[model samples]
Target: MTELVRMTGIEKRFPGVHALKQAQFDLKRGEVHALMGENGAGKSTLMKILSGIYRPDDGTVEIDGQPIELSGPKAAQAHGIGIIHQELSLMNDLTVGQNILIGKEPRRSFGRLDERELNRQAGELLGSMHMKLDPKTIVAELTIARQQMIEIAKALSNRSRILIMDEPTAALTDAEVSELFAIIGRLKSEGVGIIYISHKMDELKRIADRVTVMRDGEYVVTVEAADTPVSTIISMMVGRALKEETVTIPDLDTAETALSVRGLNRGRVIRDVSFEVRHGEILGFAGLMGAGRTEVARAIFGADPKDSGEVFVHGKPVSIGTPKDAVRAGIGYLSEDRKHFGLALGMDVRANIAMASLGQFTDMAGRLDEKAMQATANDYIERLAIRTPDDRQEVQLLSGGNQQKVVIAKWLLRDCDILIFDEPTRGIDVGAKGEIYRLLAALAADGKAIIVISSELPEILRVSHRIAVMCEGRLTGILPGGAGTTQEEIMHLATLRDAMTEEHA
Candidate 1:
């Protein structure tokens, strides 16, 4: 293999942070190199330099043995480098076609945009990628997975040779991941090198050819993917060997039911979904994207209107017509989109933590008791082990795991006994994910019924006492967690739709 992209002695620094310290990376032609690191470890910084999003303070970037300067993203694209960010960057107000061909739109003879040609080109590009989507469809109407696909399509449309993918599988389903891996294979065969950044060890083993570990803004080691153990890679990234945890199977036979949903129906997403979660039990919801797992959580949390359903909490039927009603009924929902739906990112951590339980901290005259609120925030910050400079620090400045902990703190302060964590560890690193799992285990053992909805099968098996599989909009099957359960079985149930009595299932 030939080295296609190389950065040596790379160093970058921000105002108060040394983002990269002599970080080095090399991508060989047709090879998928995985970058492993904890948050703030300079992986993104290095890639941003490579993608022309940031200029290196000092270093050398070489392309095919020739030194080059990346002035901006367009220059990087012109130089055969493209990056698909972890966050979706498409415009929701535009059509799919417009979003895809934003800066590269086709023009008519009269110097106007060619709408038909734009849609036709976008449709052709999607078809080439084996995506089934209408170019005329509104971007906002598409699901997150579809939007991620559009992001990928936009990157590929640039004919980039050196592609950098940042957590591309974070929102994709197993089937979609397979499709993406296939696309990577095809691209690699065409001599395209990929810099794959992800927290999923299994994905690294499956698709990557080499693994590079970074710790605290410096490159630690790079090794062959197959020769390196996942544990070893994790150790290199964290500078310590982290112990792998196993969930303790608690006996729930004598426990009382904490939450029960019967005949849950909402439009076409959720139908006839019935399940029960007992006190001190962690029920895992496992399913493919758009399988209605999140939808069921939303309906039960009263974030969305359910056409017909009966919800029981602590053996008492509850009418949860809104989030306020749900919160009053001891239910707390930690939405997956924490920044927008869960926390006010602009507010301080203490303020956000107190948002959910403000009624308890307010005086009779509608005055906020600052001392009481601050005490509560401090208590939870200590209890949940949230890493923050201070409670006064803004939530937006905290890491993903810390931000999530603040949301958990909000619910705990409000005395919510039934907790729903939807995609709780979506974007966090492995170490942070371990901490969260421990927190949930403690919460469940303390007699709080936990409903964990996760896209990762391993995550579903990790913390749940029993896994409930959702396909399309219904509960297809339930399996006990631990040794007996396998990914194959969960995947089978995930695709087991009522209409799929045939080959699809």
Candidate 2:
């Protein structure tokens, strides 16, 4: 293999934060090198420096045996380095081809925009990648997986020799991930070096040639993916060995039912969904991407109106037409897209934590009780192991896991008896994942009926007392959740829709 890229003695610092310290990284042509680390471990920062988004105070970068200095992203692109950022950077209103060829659009004889040539170039790029997408289609009209493919295509269209992919499959389903892996293999064969950054151990094992682990803004070690164990890599990332956690089988059969949804019908997405979560029990909703788990949760939480359903709390039917009614009925919902639906990002931690249940922290004169809110926020910050500098810090400044903890704090402060967590650990690191699992277990132990909707089968198995499998918006089966529950069994239940309907018919 050819030596393609290298960074040695990299150092970067921000206001009150040393983001990277002497971080070392290197990549060979045709190799997929994965960067592993916990949240805030400088993985993204190192990549940013490589992509010319940030200039390291002290560092040396070399490409193809030649030392180089990049002024900005365009300069980096000129040097054959391209990065697909974790967040989608596509212009929603623009056409797919227009966005892809935005700056490099071919011009006509009189300098008029040559739309045909531009679309042709973009179309050729997508076709080379074996992606069948309409160049004239609006970027916003595409699915997340397709948009991600566009991002990758845009990066490669720059004629890059090295590509940096950050959590590329974070929002993709299993089949989409497989397609991406195949694309990655093709890129590798084309001699394009890739720097893959992800927290998923399974993905690392499957797609990575070598794994580079970082800890606390410093380089830890690099090992062949086949030679390194997941446990060893995780230990290196967190600077501690992670114990294998098991879901405790709680005695929920005799426990009182806290929340029950009967005949939940929501426009073919959630059809005849019925389930009961017992007091002090953790019920896991497992399924594929569009399996209706989140729909059921939204319907129960009144975030989405159900076509027809009966919701009961404590064995009594209730009317919940809005989020306010759901919260008042002792139900709290934490959405999967926490930034948009579950939090006030611009607000302080204390304010966001108290946002859902501010009525309790209000005086007789309708003024918020600042002291009480702060105290409650501080308490939960400690309880949930939220890594925040202080309660006064903006929620946006916190990591994904900490922000999720703030959302959980809000519902707990409201004293909600039933809590529904949708994709609770999405985009969180492994160490923080353990913390969240522990918090959920503790919440259930405290008698809060918990419903966890997750796409990750391992998470569902680790956290739930009973797993409810959904297929095409219908409840297919309910299985015991534990180490004994295999992923194959869960997948079988996830696709048992036609058979289930025929059996019922």
| Top-TM-score candidate index | 1
Model 1 per-residue lDDT tens digits across residues 1-505: 9999889999997644677899999999999999989876888889999999999999999999899999999889888999998768999989999988889999999889999999999999999888999999999898888999999998998889999999898889777899999999999999999999998878988899999999878999999999988988998888888988989998899999999998999989998888899999999999888899999999999999999989999989999999999999999999887877899988998899999878888889999998888888889999988877678888865667778889888888887999999999987889889989999999999999999999988888988898988888988888888665899998888888863222211
Residue 444's lDDT within candidate 2 is: 96
Window of ten residues with lowest summed lDDT in model 1 = 496-505
Looking at model 1, the pairs that clash are none
The worst-scoring run of ten residues by lDDT in candidate 2 lies at 496-505
Per-prediction CA RMSD (Å)? 3.3, 3.0
Task: Assess candidate 2 and give its TM-score to the true structure.
Answer: 0.90
> Which residue pairs come into collision in candidate 2?
none
lDDT of 2 by residue, 255-282 (tens): 9999988888999889988888999999
What are the clash counts of all predictions, listed in order? Answer: 0, 0
